[model samples]
Target: MARFEEIGTATIPGDGTRLRLLQRNDEFSIKVAGTTGELMNSRLHGSEDALATLACDRIASQPEARVLIGGLGMGFTLAAALSALPQDARVTVAELVPEVEAWNRGPLGSAAGYPLHDARASVHIGDVAELLREGKGSWDAILLDVDNGPEGMTRKENNWLYSPAGISAAQRSLSSDGVLAYWSAGPEHAFTERLRRAGLSVEPVTVRALRPGKGARHVIWLAW
Candidate 1:
């Protein structure tokens, strides 16, 4: 049996909480310090990949599409988004933790095919909300995989990103016909309705951790 070895650590800005990067042989995982469950893993990124693909699919026709990803995670979502979009599409990923970005540029890079290496992909080492607030009608699509979805686990500050004002900001940050997508650890009916109350159309899609039907079920809300 291979034991997971801690390779690196990073502190969440607002909460001062730590996120640890672990590796067991060829596989990698990220977990909150002192947590048992993996926040993200190299092997179980199916839903993560789907989050970007689903959102990118909606805007595939735009040759120079501008996509903003809320979390870097393992770079799976960014890579998937890059793969689904046209060559000219621009993708920017906002990762709150600087160490996470470094991991993606280091040993953790290979797990998601070193997405940061892509020329069209860039990174913002700050809160994704900052960009949303300033980027009115700037992005064609916004995919948020931040903090375990609407019902955040790691950081309480992340709650605002799912709040009414946050949803409105995301709505306003989009170009006409822009789509917003979210990835959750589980179903969140309340969040879905919250989007509707904010005057946006929402579509909730269910996907698996490993594939279309091979692992635990997860929810992805695609709203516009």
Candidate 2:
């Protein structure tokens, strides 16, 4: 077995939790200490890309579309969105941890094709919830892969992102035909119901972790 080498570590702002960046040969992974374990693996990003592709595909025809992406895991979601969106479109990524953004620029940048440097993409080093609250009907689509799922792993505050109040905030942040997408490690029936109760139609999708159909199954919820 190939031994994983610890390349770097960053302390998550606010909560002080530690995130460790590990690598084995060409593969990279982000693991949260004392929490949800491995947050993401570079080799397994199919679902993450799907999270963006699924939502962006729905609004691809809209010119000058605006997209808000929560979490910057390995930049897979951001990279996928950039590929699917037009040159006039814009993408804003709100990452709760500053280190995560830095890692994307340093270690993980090549794996995701240096998406942060794209002209259409911008990164905000803050909670996505705050961005959602401040923006009103300002986005054509919102993609969330923050935490492990609706339930948070590193930060307790992330729980609100999947709560009823969080759903309402996300709804207000979207345009009339905007879609809100979520990526989860597993199914969350309760979370789907919450979206439905919030007055948005929900579409649940299951995708593989690796492209070409491999790895564990992940779920994505598209609500509008």
Best by TM-score: 1
List of clashing residue pairs for candidate 2: none
At residue 160, candidate 1 shows an lDDT of 87
Candidate 2 lDDT over 6-57, as tens digits, reads 8888887788888889899878988977655578889899999999999999
The residue-by-residue lDDT of candidate 1 on 145-175, one tens digit each, is 9988887899888898999989999999999
Error of 1 at 193 (Å): 0.8
lDDT against the true structure, each candidate: 0.93, 0.91
lDDT of model number 1: 0.93
TM-score of each: 0.98, 0.96
Clashing pairs in 1: none
Best by lDDT: 1
Residue 178 Cα positional deviation in candidate 1, in Å, after optimal superposition: 0.4
* Alpha carbon lDDT at 220, candidate 2: 95
What are the runs in model 2 whose C-alpha is more than 4 Å off? 34-36
